[model samples]
Each structure stands twice: as structure tokens, then as C-alpha cells.
Target: MAGNPVVTDWTTDFDHTDKAWAADPYPIMDELRDTCPVAHSDRFGGAWLPTRHEDVSAIANDTEHFTSRSIVVSEHRPPMELAPEGIAPPISSDPPFHAQARRMLLPVFSPQTIDKLEPSTRAYCQELLAALQGKDVVDAAADYAAHIPVRVIANMLGLPEEDGDKFRGFVLHVLEGVALPLEERIVGFQQLFEYLMPQINDRVANPKDDLISFLLASELDGKPLDPFHVVRTVALLLIAGIDTTWSAIGASIWHLAKSPTDLKRLVNEPELMPTAIEELLRAYAPVTMARLVKEDFEFQGCPMKAEDWVLLSFPAANRDPAFFENPDEVILDRSPNRHAAFGLGIHRCAGSHLARMEMRVALEEWVKVYPDFSLEDAGAVRWSGGQVRGPRVLPIQVGP
Candidate 1:
């Protein structure tokens, strides 16, 4: 993969997991969108990569053709086999089943629920910002952005608030630990699940108001949720909960910190914070979903075979000029912004409201305190590769 040519055309065997590709994917995404709107890769058995906005959206919404049963087609991890009956819900199940699983979890993330959670979320943001006041240096990714979502979500799920940093470490290990030996990656997953089982057991015994407890007590498909299903859903939350929002928050702040003009505009006209967050999400989306081709299909002139993996790049789709004006530019108030940063269709992020609130509050708080910060050194930053991508370390100088 190191020797793979710079993505110049559709024929180029693009391995997105390659470090060089990870360092800067937009160029590759652009070339892929231009040349190989639907690309086939030799990796992961075989995959179809679609970068065009319309193509990705149409495919995502066309679930009858593609299924989310195997959303991860990792170069590092082994390909997962789908069970005859889907393993869990929402993420792994297609509609009817997907809707049932999604519906079971909807109340926890409803607009009203997220709005109710905002007051605590805001206070936590303020506490973090206030603690950084006297520091001349801050690692935005670690010292700041990383902690926000972990703490907020951990509390929301009735996990130990003090365990936030510990959970973040577990998440980083699994998400980026693929860079380590395969055994090490497995160990990370083991550590996460071992840590979780006790909580799941405790929830079953006590039946509290937390997410794990709620799942333990809740019914599914006209039956009480299976213990395995409850654990798997909580595990999914552990995986999805930590890094996606953390990456978006870190990436958006990193974008502003690097650009004084953009940072200042947001600082001066804070009302645009809402729109700015949306633009930032579009420009720096942190998640790309993969789907398994349910059957052979020819659409957009690309023939995909069943069992082929397809990466639906929301990041790439947001940058597609067909849907966005000046797709490359992060206009603070880009209205009518129809970006799929939270994804599209039935599999859209369930926690979109909470994620949006967290992003805006993070920027608002940081701008008030450290709008003038800059990177410690350009090379001080490092991006991680794998499904969830963002700056793993964002060292910044707040003042002299």
C-alpha cells in the first residue's frame, strides 16, 4: 500500500487505509469522484467505492440493493460474516427490523431529550474551558475535545463519570489500535467487552434508568430484549459514542485554530456558530460508512457484485460540487446546506441533535477563551487511520 500510486484515476488501486491516503484523502476522494465514481478495490475480497454525492445518496437510500449488515470492511480487521438472522439491531438489521431497533432507541435521542440534556452538556463545556484558562498550551484533541463527548455520553448512559478518560483510552485502542499487532487489537476489544459485561450484569440486576438498564428491561420484537442484544447495543454505543463526536469537535476546532480569519469571523459573529458548525461538519466529517452489496447491480454505469464492500463517504459526498456551492470552501453561514455529515436515510446518526449541540457549545466556549490559539507546530498534529478519522493529537499554543 505504501507503494500504491497517488490516486490518479479509477484504475488506480486505491487503498484508503494507506497512511499517505489518510494524511490527505480529499485529493484521493476528488480523483475517485472524478475518475472512479464507483471504484472496485482488490482489498476486502473486493469493494465498490462511490464518491459522487448523488451516487452515494441514491445508493444509501436504496437499501434494497445494499445492506448495512457489514458496515465495516476494514483492511486491518478480518471481514465479518453476517448471520442467517442478523446479529443485532438498527446498525446490523435492514428495514422493518432496522426500524424496530431504531424505534426502541429513539426516545433517548429525541429533540426534546437532547434539549433536556443540553444544560448539563453546556456546564461541562464551561467547566472544561474554565480549567484551561491559565494554561499557555493545550492539546485540543486530548486536553479538550476528547473529554467532552466521553464525559457527556458516559454520564448520559449512567456510566461512572470518573471513568470518562478510561473509556476514551479503550475507544482509541480499538479504533486506532489496528496499527498495532492484530493480537493487540483483539486484546483491546476484549478489554472493552470485559469492562462492559459487568455493567450489563449490574444493569440487569438493579435495572436503573441508564441506557444499559433501559435496554435490559426493554422489549424487542414483542419479546424482552435478549441479554446478548442488550450487551451488543451497549458495545456499539461504546464504539460509536466516543470518537465520532470527538473527531468532529477536534477537527472543527483544528480548522478554526489554523485559520485566523475563519476563527475571528465566528468569534465576532457568534450567532453564525450554528451554521459554522454545519459547514465544519461538512468539510471535516469524521465517519464514512461501508455497506455490503446485497446483490449484483448496475447503476451509474458501475456494476457491483453481491458480497462486494462499498464505502459511502459522507466526507466525500459533502464536498461534491454537484450538491454544494464552493464545496471546498467552509463558508460560515452556508445556507441550504444539504450535507450528509450525519449521514442520510434510515441509518443516519441517531444522536445528531446531541452531536450538533456539543459541537456548537464546544466552539462557542473555546472561541470565548482561546480564539487566538494556533498549532504548536504543524507537524505536532497527527491523524489516525481506520473507520473513525481525526487528529489524534492537536497541540496548540494558547498564549505566550
Candidate 2:
């Protein structure tokens, strides 16, 4: 019970099931890093929170010591398995094997691929921003952040851009674990599968020039991928699409709304947007990943038990004082940023390129059209709770 006193602090302790942590976790995260760098919790059948930057990087990269078989920390629900094989490949998979799936998918979104797609991406941003013109208020999360990735990912998957809203619902329900029971979230996954089953099957029968069709045509060891494998990959793609950048964009806007000086700098200095975004990525870093302990190993002085959940708080890692100078402050053009917002190791976020592009465009366009804006109502602004974090309802006062 040595760790209990600090763990029971209640004010700073973190548990995924606790609604309080979701609202504002930074204070508790600060407490953990300062006091218990490697803290334990009883909520999810005993999970470890690695608060320091080096600890997170070490755990995430050491495949021999930790496994990516499961990343979600839940007492009742095991981590969702990826399809293509026993592994989810790249994201939820260990090295070597993860590379197999990753290699094939990389060319799809390679620099060359995205270069060709940039014009369309720009068009989408303009179109979305144009719709909000003349409006006094904006739901940055839903109106701007939510719609861009939904449409972009939809277009990548060959789904209609109009279906973006429907995709947003599934992503919010399943990944965010927002206002719904665990069972309901499971059903949401099924709903997406059922919804896409016919299209996936159709792609198999009559191959098209899209991601699904491309996956269907792909061969491993000269054999076509299994249907389950393909569907699981699609599920990962769907859930991953909207929320990550949605959080980054919402958090960035929220920061600017709270900081008029920073907002003004970017609005006037467009060239600084790139590095400024990097700084924001570090400060508002989202997405915490879990690695299943492969064996009973003493990791950085902490005894990690086998199969126990060891969550790498990339967000916390980004805020580490040792790793970053003035870790709390968001310095525009913060250089030498080695944050793990995208993640570390072979499972580093596959969509990092798309995410940056989406975010840059989102912020660049917003600042161009709107002047310095502030939170419409500070009390009503809401953030999402779950592994992937973001503001679900971001109301900003942009117009007079």
C-alpha cells in the first residue's frame, strides 16, 4: 500500500473509468510526473501510467518487453484485436510483423500520394470554411474539425464525402466512449461493419480504385487477405480518421482562444504556422497508448507485471520538463520537438502526414477569415473522454 497514499490523493490520481479525469487531466498528470513518475491504478485491474518522457519512449519501443496486442485499459473489456492477422498491423502490432501491413499501406499515403491529394484537400477546407462565412459563432469541433477528417478519410476509403457525418457518429461513440455504455460501443462497431460489409464485398467482386479495393487486391504470401483482416483494418481506419486531428484542432483553437497573443502571432505570421503547429502538437498532445506487459520485467525501476496495462502517456511525455524547455508554455516555433503525439516505435501513427496537413489547413484557413476569437461560453465548452481525447463541443465567438 506504499503507493496508495499518493494514488488515493483523488485530486491527482487518474483512472479511465472516472469521469473527473476526462474533464481536465493536466493537473493530475503534473502531480503524477512530479511525485509518482510511474504510477499505478486499480480502476482497470491495475494499470501503470508512465508520466515521464524517457519511460514512455522506453516502454513503447521495447517490443521484447512489451506487446502491442492490446492498448485499451478496461477491467471488463480486453483490447480490441486487429484483423489482417492476429495483429492490427502497424498501429496495434509489434515490430517486424507490423511492418508487413505497414509497408503495403505506406505507399497509399506516401508524400507523393498526399501531394496529388493536396489540391482537393485545400478545396475541402475552403468549401467548409466558406459555409461558415457570415456566421457569428462556430462549433470548431463539429463544424470544422469533425467534418474535414471525416470527409478526407471518407474520400480515401471511397465513401461519399456527404456520409462524413454518419462516420463521425460511429467514431465518437466507439473511440471516445462518450455518453454510452461499453455494450453500446461494441454495437457501434458492428453497425459500421454491417454498413460497410456490402461495399467491401462489392469491392472484392468488382475491384475499384480505392483503399478498400486496394486492400482486397493485396496479397500476402501470394494469397488474398482474409475478409476479417480487411474489415478490421477498415475499422481501425474509420475510428482513427476523425478523432485524432479533431482533438488537435480543437485543443489548438482552445489554446489560441485562451491566449490572444499567440493567436495574433499566427494570424499575422503565416510562415510560422508550421513550427507553431509543432509547438501546439507538443503542448496539446493527445492519444495515450497501452502496451500489454510481455513478461514480469523491472522497467525503469517499476516492476511491470505480465499482461498488465502499461499506458504510455504521450501527452505527458510531451510535457516532460527534462525533455522540453519550459514544458508548460507553448512557444511558437518550438524547435527540436521530439514529442510522441504521433507515437513512437513501429506503431507510430500511420496517418501523421494526413493529420499535419489537415491541422495546418484548418488553422491557416481559420486565422485568415476570422480575427482574434474567444470562447463563446467558457463553462459550456466540453472535452471528450477516452484513449483519444479532444473537445467534442467547441463554441467560439468569432464574429461581432
Candidate 3:
């Protein structure tokens, strides 16, 4: 965040980590979607930005031209051979093997499984809200939104809930620290696996009723999963699960705090909560996934070179006018909406069900407790840089 150069032209020399992009990328994306839908940049060892929904979907579905070898766009690309089971399983894995890896994890994220987590997730949301009581103004993001997923994921991974701070540190370094020096970044990544190794080893010796243990007991290709595979998958769960959902929840609360009409509607018509949640997700979709060009080829008039980074902007796609009605507007009851907030194609977020449940419960609890809230200082609300965007420092007045 500190060392990245300022972006001169979003279309040509784009840097997703730039302050302007993080503050408000919709305008930037809208411009690109119209003028240069497949914008190219030389940064991050060359990268492409496709703001159109169709292009994003095409590239996401086309595994032959792009590989998930390195989902994060940075100076250091993971080796080409890492594919089929990239650093992380499923999300980072490519086809054939991607299907097998993804299929194995499907049972863990099935709706039935997530439904079982809702009660505790809701209770955790209530617990967070309880702490905000009697305060005129509160940091909605730090105090409420950020903690929900941390607790939920910690419980799932069989880790100590109090280690939320550590988890946050890991997420930040992995997601937002893309521009850091390669050596420093490597050390940061090592720390995460180092922390998880003991937990994984403990599960191996004394298996428990958690995801780590489940993976250990599980088989891949008719053989037990390797220890490192278990570690990488667990790392994926920790990193992916916390950051994206936290952003979604925080962004939703940020929206409600500013839009009284929408807030009042959800409060008055409780049944609209489900529909409204999707609307929020579409309007403020947080994640932008990255892929490496498999080989040099032309795409939508652009000559993409092999190993070039392609940032599949799901947030931008969700706002493409070609795909949705009044793409820029947030219509709570927008039924038949097919926004790709979770993502498109094979690598779509696996924990989407759990994410939705977290967002719904978090919003419901917040609104139930503080029905009338507004942005305390719009200027003070800080949005995170890099792929995932959200209100990281949202301050809201508790009541009207």
C-alpha cells in the first residue's frame, strides 16, 4: 500500500491498489467498460482489466487460455507446474483436477451445512451488537462487521477465537500486500503456514470434529491428502473466508447507514431482507479475482501475452449495463437478478452460502438493534485497496 506508484491512466497504466481506485472504482470501471473494455497495463509484470461482464465470464470459463496458477496479481508468479492443485486447492486449482478438488469440498459448503452454522453466526452477530450498545457513534466495520466472519471461520477451523487479530494480519498481508518486495512477501506467507503447521499436526495426532480433521480423514484420487495439501487448503479457508465476507457485511452496513429509505424498507418489510442482501452484494461487490494468461493470444482485440495478469473484475461485471437493468442503481427487490458477486465459472467462491448467511444475520442484527443510523463521517470511511474493496473504517451514528 505504501510503495505502489500512483496510477496515471486507469485504462493503460492501471493499479488496483491506487487510492483513487479504492475510494471509488465504479466510475473508473464504467469508463473502461465503454471506451476500452479490455484495458491493458504494464504493471504487475503486465496485466489486463476486463470491465465487461461477458468478457469476464468468457475468461473465467476459458481455462485453456488462462490459468489459476497464481490468483493474486503480483511480481512473483507461481510456477506453471503448480496448476491442477495450485498453492491452494479448489480455488487455485485448474480443470480436471480442479473438478476433483472442488467436488471434494462441495459437501462442506452445501446449503445444509451452512444452515447448521446460521444459529451460531446469528448469535455471534448479536454478541457483536451487544457490545456497541449505549454508544452514540460506533465503528461499524471494526467493531461489528469484521468480527463476525472471524468468529465463524475460527469455529469452523477449530482454532482459538481470540486469535482473530492474527487471522486479520494474515489476510491483510496476503490480499493487500501485493506490492511488497518479493522477499518480504515470501517471509509473510511463511509465517502463515508456520502458524498452521502445529494446528494441522495436532489434528493429525488427535483428529477432531473440524474442517482440518475432515480434510485429513478425507481422500483425494483414492489416496489420503498430503499434509501440505491440508495446510494449503486450510490457509485458503482462513484467508478467503474472512476477508471477502467481512467486506460484504461492512459494505452492506455502510450502505444502510447512508440510505435511510432502503434501511426503512428493510426494517418495515422484513421479508425483503433476502432480496435486499443480493442487491447490496451486486451494487457493492467486493472481490476482483486474478488469473495468469496461459499463452500469448489475442482477446477482444487485445494481444495478451503469456503470464500476463488478468484481473477479472466481478465488481465491475456486476455493474455492466449490458447485463443488468440500471446497473448502477441498487434495487432491493430486483428479482431475477443474475449478478456474479461470488464470481463466475469453476473457481466461484465455495463458501458463498456461508457468506450470504453471515451478511444476512449481521445486517439483521445491526438493523434490529440500531434501526436509525447514519454515516458519522463519510470522509473518515476508509476503503481497502487491492482486489477486495470495502469500508474498513466505517463510523456510524447509532441513532437519529
Candidate 4:
């Protein structure tokens, strides 16, 4: 196969899935962006790389042109029947269908609804921070970052507080990818499915004042949602909402720990939390890729066939010079910051408002109280998985 015309030092055989690659992708992405804006890599068994801001944005927004149906990496694509993410297009479903599925959960995640949850969100953040008081060093990932989102989701779903730990464990295992054995991952998925089934049944039998109940009660096109669809929808929310927010939280903590000045700034100007949230997302850019492809045309001179996958590199896009001035620097008060951290277009993250509220509350509270915290050891900050970017262990030494 021919290399991308724009690529100068293209190597299609490079393994993007290598452990080292996951550990620090920015350097490689930088190289790719500069030398090969549209390179192809055989790492995931052949996938095109579009590193420039315009290319990534175009692919992300033009769903009609670039269909979001198949896997970007051929090797990672699961069998059509067995793939949960692949089934029925769901978020990726074009237009009317996408809108329908999205609407199912939109009310629960609307900005007004998310704002109503702020008090509880702030309370949870304070509780987490309180537990860390007087500790010289604590793993932020395990102790603080990971717990908040899972707890919020569990509570929202009306699951018992006691079940949050178990649910979180299962979700973490599933996200660990190759770190956990294949059989263990399968078991985790099965456990998650089994765990939710009873809740689904209960919601159906006796609807409550919770998200699950709402889903059970709500109808699409004058008919109640199918049970399987309910399960899949809930599963999608559980996985996407929990992991992405968790990673963002962990990464934000890491960034702050690494920069005491930034921490101090946020502590002083609490209103800057919103802008800080966007900046954190821009710098870290947690979710790496969004898969899509053209249905019937060429994009940027590249002819894309039906079912061919094109990956939108948001992290790379956020850093592209064409979009943000001083893209690498963290400007806490950055306005007009339209970065697609949550994503763009119809499939943008449904729970983003809640996610931002969670992050803002967590940051505002944590920094205000623990302004003196710092990473216990820079080298000890290791991440758990590739698909998700987060510190596995973020030990911090905080003042009382």
C-alpha cells in the first residue's frame, strides 16, 4: 500500500499498541503531526492517521461523509454479531436514529439536571478530600479520582451504595484491556451484564425515581424500549460515563500536582473552574480516537470506501497550531475554547454536562482545601490502560 502523500517519514508497520507507545503517545503524535499529517500505521493491523486539526475536525463533524460504523483498526474490530459497540449504530447511527437513541438519556444529562446534582457532587468531593486529610501521601487515582465518578453513576442508577465498589471493580477490570487476562475480561463483562439484569428487571417491575426507572418508563416512537436495548444503553452509559470522567479526574489531578502555580491560581480564582476544566481536557485529551469513515466520497483527497474506518485524533487535534494559540500552555481563563474533549456533532458525549460539573466541583473543592499537595514521586505515576488514559497510582503528599 502507498504511504500518505503528506507523510515524509512514514512507516506503516509501526505498532501503535505497544506498551511504550501508550505510556507516552504525545511525542509520537507530535512526530506524526509534523511529518505525516495523514500517515498510515500497521500497528493495529493498518489504520490511517489524520493528525492535523482540520482533518480530525472535518472527519468528526461530517458523519455523513465519514460513516461511524466500523472499527478504525482492522485487528481490533470484533465480529459484527458479538460487538456491543458495533450493534445498531447507537450513538454512531446517522441522523434520525442517532437523535432518537441520544434523546433517551439526554434529559437525565441535560445542563439543568446536571446543575441540580452539583450539591451532591460537591459533597462527594469534600468527603473524598476529607478522607485524605493528615495523610502524607495517598494514591490519588485509587483514593480520590476513581471513586467519585463510579459513585455518582451508581447513585444515579439507584444502585445501593454498597454495590458501587463491586461495580467499579468490574468496570476497571474491563478497561484494563490486555493487563487483565482475556478470560478475566470476559468474566468481568458477564458479571456486569448479570449485575445490571436484576436492576433492569426491578426498574421494569416497580419503576422508581432514578435513571434506570426513567429509561424503563420512557418510550421510543410510542413503544417502550426493548429490554436488550435498555441493557446496551445502560451499559454504554456505565462504561463511557464512568471511565472517561475517571480518567479526566485522574489526569487533572496529575497536571495540578505537577504545577503548584496552576493549583494556586485555581485556589485563588474559584470561578475559573469552568475554563480550567476545558484547559485540563485540552492538555490531557483523555479519549484518544473516534472511529468513522466516508460513505460515498473522498475527504482531503483520500478516497474512503464504505465500511473503511477513519480515526479522529482529538488529543492531536487539540494540540494542532491551527486551532488554539499556544496549544500546549494551560490558560485557565481561556475563552472561545471550543475543543472537542467531550466530542463534537450528534455523538458528542451525552453525559458531558454531568462530567464537567463533576470535574469542576471536584477541582474547586480539592484545590481550595489541599492547595499544598504534590505528587509523592513523579516516576510512580503510571497509567492503567491504553483506551483510557489515567494514572494507575497518583500518590500525593498533602498538608493538613
- Model 2 TM-score relative to the real fold: 0.92
Residue-by-residue lDDT tens digits, candidate 2, 197-251? 8879888888878998988888765788877678777777877868888899889
Best by TM-score: 3
Q: Which residue window of length 10 is worst by lDDT in model 3?
A: 125-134
Against the reference, the lDDT scores of all candidates come to 0.79, 0.78, 0.92, 0.72
TM-score per prediction, in order, is 0.92, 0.92, 0.99, 0.88
User: 85-130, model 4: which lDDT tens digit per residue?
Assistant: 3543365455556677777778899998888889988899899888
lDDT of 4: 0.72
Kindly provide the TM-score of model 3 when superposed on the true structure, using C-alpha atoms: 0.99
* Reference-based lDDT, residue 142, model 4: 85
- What value does the lDDT take at residue 27 in candidate 4? 73
Candidate achieving higher TM-score, 1 or 3? 3
Show where candidate 3 strays beyond 4 Å: none
Please provide, for model 3 over 1-400, each residue's C-alpha lDDT reduced to its tens digit, 9 standing for 90 to 100. Answer: 8787898888899999999999999999999999999998998889999999999999999999999988988889987778779999988888889898888888999999999999999888888888777889999989988999999999999999999999999999999999999998999999999999999999999999999999999899999999899999999999999989999999998988888999899999989999999999999999999999988999988999999999999999999999998998888999888989999888889999999999999888888998888999999999998999988999999965
Who wins the lDDT comparison?
Answer: 3
Please count the clashing residue pairs in each candidate, in the order shown: 0, 1, 0, 4
Report how far residue 144 has shifted in candidate 2, in Å: 1.1
